[model samples]
Target: YLDVDLSLDQVHLYLCEYLRMKDLEGPYNAELVPVVTKAHRSDAVPSLTQHELDAILFEVTEANENPEYPAVAVLFQYDAAVAHNALGVTGKAQWGVLAGYDRERQLARIIDANAKAFGRSWSVTCEWLLQAITGYGYIVMRHVGRLLRRQSVRGSASM
Candidate 1:
């Protein structure tokens, strides 16, 4: 059994907020979808394979299920579908006080991981992936950009 310090309601709210910030919503919240058009990124570079997608999903599920934040599992599953449906990157908008990592750090880690995996900056990788998948990457980039903007504002405000 996973033990979380926060109530389930709190986790749910955070999940919704994250989705709102990302502009990803709808039935199943599935951002990933079949694409009939050939994307420039995929044509120029290699396409993202189902195997890669499965691996990423596995990692996210494991992270979400970590006992530190019990509600994270549900939140993750919910957001992932939303992001997938929107063709959004599955790792953005990783907010909340769950699973031991704060929202910002979680976003950063995922961005960094994508950058390392794709040999591009976080934003570039997100764009490439979205283009590869059809259009979901744009949604992820928007949320990540929002987070970056917020951080910048907060930093300037602190001065």
Candidate 2:
């Protein structure tokens, strides 16, 4: 029922703000504790502690279901790690954006099929939610870039 506009940047900002409010730090926070713990506890490259993985899973689940923080799901799902694995970070950002578009189209088809099966209209809000989920990854990165630019400008101005 949220009036979501499917802009990647906006989605990212919403997610960043939501996580900030929740005091969840960011997606990387979950990994940090475990990685550090493993560095000391074992010689193997530190893997996520069960607790860290659980936190990430919980966030992903909440983001997928909650309209208010749709970007969180996207961030966790298509992170830099995934992007790097796919095409390396050289053009990963662009790839992520294009991938989001593809995802949106695919999700739309699925949603449409489900709606038909249930004999319900694919209402505007439902469409919005679908777009939010599918386009979440691109949006989060865009949002982060914008925020960094703003901070840079402010810092320069202050100097």
Candidate 3:
């Protein structure tokens, strides 16, 4: 539903805002990190290193275990060619990248896993749906209102 293409910084800010709205009591909050590789450079074909994977897996485990933070979601952006080598291989200490419908399915699995690990239900939602429709007009405004109401109800019940 989100139409706007946000830069990484903007996404971080929005994530912070959403976390704030959660009103979770903690010493630390959720953090979003963008990992970029220089594979596009002709000089070097950078791939996700084992150390990097270990660090990311550690972060994911920490995020799940830390009482101060709810969760950490790593968004990886990579070229198809680089991903093919970096992800599809077996016996590698790296997590494979899921794309298209598989990405959505894997995301759901992650949410479910987090829910079990944290003893709570987890869900993902995009903020731009409200941002995009609010200024459009009456029909859009009504739709946004409904969406807001639904979200508020769900949030209230969940938290």
Best by TM-score: 3
Candidates 1 and 3 compared by TM-score, better number: 3
Tell how far residue 87 is off in model 2, in angstroms. 31
Stronger candidate by lDDT (1 vs 2)? 1
Candidate 1, residues 15-66, lDDT tens digits: the string is 4576677665431132222232354344544333433333333334444454
lDDT (10s digit) by residue, model 2, range 1-159: 112233445544565676578865543221101122332456554233333333333333334454453433223222222322333433221212111222233221112212222222222222333222332222223222122222333323231
| Candidate 3 lDDT score at position 1 | 18
Across 75-150, the per-residue lDDT of candidate 3 in tens digits comes to: 3222222222234432211121111112233221112212222223322111221121121111101111112222
Clashes of 3: 0
Q: For model 3, what is the alpha-carbon lDDT of residue 8?
A: 42
Error of 3 at 61 (Å): 4.3
Clashes in each model (backbone N, CA, C under 3 Å)?
A: 15, 1, 0
Model 1 local distance difference test score: 0.31
Local lDDT at 116 for model 1: 31
> Candidate 3: lDDT over CA atoms?
0.29
